[model samples]
Target chain A: MLFKNLFHHFGRYVIMLGSAFSKPERASMYYKETMRQMNDIGIGSLFIVCLIAIFIGAVTAVQFSYQLDGTLVPVYYIGYVVRDMTIIELAPTFTCLVLAGKVGSNIAAEIGGMRQKEHIDAMEIMGVNTAAYLIMPKVIAALIVIPMLVAVGAFISIIGGYLASVPTGVMADADYIKGLRSFFDPFNVTMMFIKALVFSFILTTVPAYQGYHVRGGSIELGQASTNAVVFSDILILVADYLLAVVLTS
Target chain B: MIRTEDIFKSFDETEVLKGITTEFYKGKTNLIIGRSGAGKTVLLKLLVGLLEPTSGKVWYDDTDFFALDRKQMRNIRMEVGMLFQASALFDSMTVEENIRFPLDMFSTLTLKEKRQQVDKCLERVNLEGANANFPSEISGGMQKRVGIARAIVLDPKYLFCDEPNSGLDPKTSIVIDELIRDITIEKNITTIINTHDMNSVMEIGDNIVLLYQGKLAWRGTNEDVLESDNATLQDFIFASPFLQRLRDAALKRG
Candidate 1:
């Protein structure tokens, strides 16, 4: 029974996405909607993303500094560890997991409310190809903007490490700067972007599926929103693991 | 005109509509009236392609709606407009913006032309100069009017209104009914209204279909209602003792 239910949902989700990728009845309307979504997702969440990144970087640096205090590893290695840890793992994963809760729930609620209010029906009867008009713009915007946010997050996290260690006397400024500039592999940055893009697709589309197929009243809508966040978080972790193994191998 | 052929809809083993076949005519206000669970809304949804019939066919003029490809289906939809019960205007958009959304999505009109069309629609719905107000900021009657404006904005050939007067005052209900009827005649469009409001029935019901227990029980115009001998129709139309007595008196006089 569970497998049947899963297959049903999976099939419906794939079909919904298939319909969402069709040709737009009008190009300019889609472009305008995409721009609006970009502004909302990118600029709207920038501050919170930056704030969380700084805290993550600081904690990682502080804990690593403690761990390395009596070890063979040099103090400058704290900078390298923070930098690599951030770009390779923390930036894309942490940022997207947070976004899965913040933006994912909002998307689910917005679309689900539209469903209940019959806006989707109205659009459909207008020949608008509602799946394309509603879902495509949001997906496109997330694909474009999420990677940029992750890049910004990675940069901010490194600064956070500096602020936590250097000015606080945990480490010397020269050693930290040397650590940051030392042993930088550009491939790690490429890996970060690939993770960002994959995670972006998951976070946006999962919530959209939940919202688009939502049935019943407000309570059902709330459950869909909650499910969007929970499912998105779980899938992001799974995807992170899979991408790590696949990309590394 | 639209025609249904042996339409049936089932939801998880519960048959909501059973072999319902009917015809709604052009340039007339066609009403589908029934009790709450008699499948009025379901039938309307089936007609508009929002819900597919379990095993039946719907015809739009000479075309079979279900047999069409995606592009052809969209071509049919382009000529259709629907007014939902709650009006379904986008909350974030102003009244004018809501009406202009369809135009913006499908029409090739320039910005000025689109604005002009929006204004014309708003004027027709008697909502001129109320362009910037959000749906939440307006009364329910005005919201319904705005919904009507949006529906007619594209000059659709087929308009579907579901319970267009559910929560309005008698005066507003009559106004809405007249507006819908006037638009139907003016545009020579096929207008299907799913409603149980007796005032709407007597006022503008050029064609009426009554469903009882998923089966179409009766169909006639407002003129036929006074003299019809169908017990189901008579029972539905004159549920109250007062109305029944009134109908009896009218029949005796006739």
Candidate 2:
């Protein structure tokens, strides 16, 4: 029964995406909507992304310094550990997980509200492709903007680690700088971007699908919003694990 | 003209609409009236292609609506307009922007021309000079008028209104009904209204289809409603004791 339900939802979700990506009626209208979504999702999320990233980097630095207090591993390794971890996993994963709650729920609620209010029906009868008009711009905006936010997050996280380690006597500035400069593999950045793109797609489209298919009244709408966040976070984690295996191997 | 051929709609295991075949003529106010859960809304949704019939067909004029491809359906939709019960105006946009949405999406008119068209529609709805107010800032009657303006902005050949008087006072409801009636005549468009308001029925109902338990229970005009002998129609139209007394008095006086 569970498997059947899963397949049912999966099939419907695929069909919804098919309609969402279909040819738009007007390119100019879509462009305007995309810009609005970019402003909402990208600019709306900057502060939270930056805040979470800094704390994650700081905690990682503090814990690693404690672990390396009397070890053969040099204290400068804290900088290296923080850099690689932030680049390879923490920045993209953590930031998007937060966004899955913030932006994902908002999208679900907004679109679900529109559905309940019959705004979607009105648009459909006006000859607008509601799925394409409503969902595509959001997906496009997320795809473009999320990666850029993840990049900024990664940079801020490194600075956070530097501040935690060097300014707090956990390590000397010279040693931390040496660790940061050493053993830098560019492939890690590629992995970060891959995760960012996949996570972005998951976060935006999941919520949109939830919203688009919502039924019933305000209670049902709230449920859809919650489902959007939960499903998006789960999918992002699953994709993260899969990408780590594929990209690393 | 819009017609449905044996339209049936089912959800899960329950059938909501059962073989509802009807016609809405051009330049007439065609009303679908029923008690709550009589499938009036479902029938309306099906007629507008919002819900696909389970085992039947809908025809927009001579074209089979369900048989059309996506692009073809969209092209046909360009000639259709719907006024939702809640007005469904985009809350973020002002009245001018809300009415201008359809033109902005589909019309190739320049900005000045679009504004001119918006002004014209607003004036037609008797809502001129109220352009900058958002839907939230307007009364329910004003919102419904704005909804009408938006619906007719594109000069649609088919207009569907879902309970245009749902939340309005009787006077406002009468005004909305008359506005819709005038527009139907002026444009010669096929206008189908889903409503149960008796005032609307008597005032603007050019043709009426009454549904009882998902089936077409009765069909006639306002003139026939008072004289019809159909038990289901009489039971529905005169459900209240006060109305039944009035009906009896009218029959005695006649």
Estimate, for each residue in A1-249, the C-alpha lDDT of model 1 and write its tens digit: 999998998999999999999998889889999999999999998998999999989999999999998889989999999999999999999999999998999999999999999999999899888888899999999999999999999999999999999999988999999999999999999999999999999999999999999999999999999999999999999999999999889
Model 2 lDDT on a 0 to 1 scale: 0.94
Clashes of each: 0, 0
Off by over 4 Å in 2: none
Residues B1-254, candidate 2, lDDT per residue (tens digit)? 99888988999999999998889999999999999999999999888888888989888888999999978998999999889999999999999999999999999999999999999999999999999999999999999999999999999999999999999999999999999999999999999999999899889989999999999999999999988999999999999899989988988998
Q: After superposition, how far is residue A184 of candidate 1 from its true place, in Å?
A: 1.2
DockQ of 1: 0.88
Q: In angstroms, how far off is B167's CA in candidate 1?
A: 0.5
lDDT tens digits, residues B1-254, model 1? 99999999999989999999999999999999998899999999999888999999999998999998877888899899888999999999999899999899888899899999999999998989989999999999999999999999999999999999989999999999999999999999999999999989888999999999999999999999877989998888898898878978987998
Q: What is the C-alpha lDDT of each candidate?
A: 0.94, 0.94
For candidate 2, what is the DockQ-based docking class? high
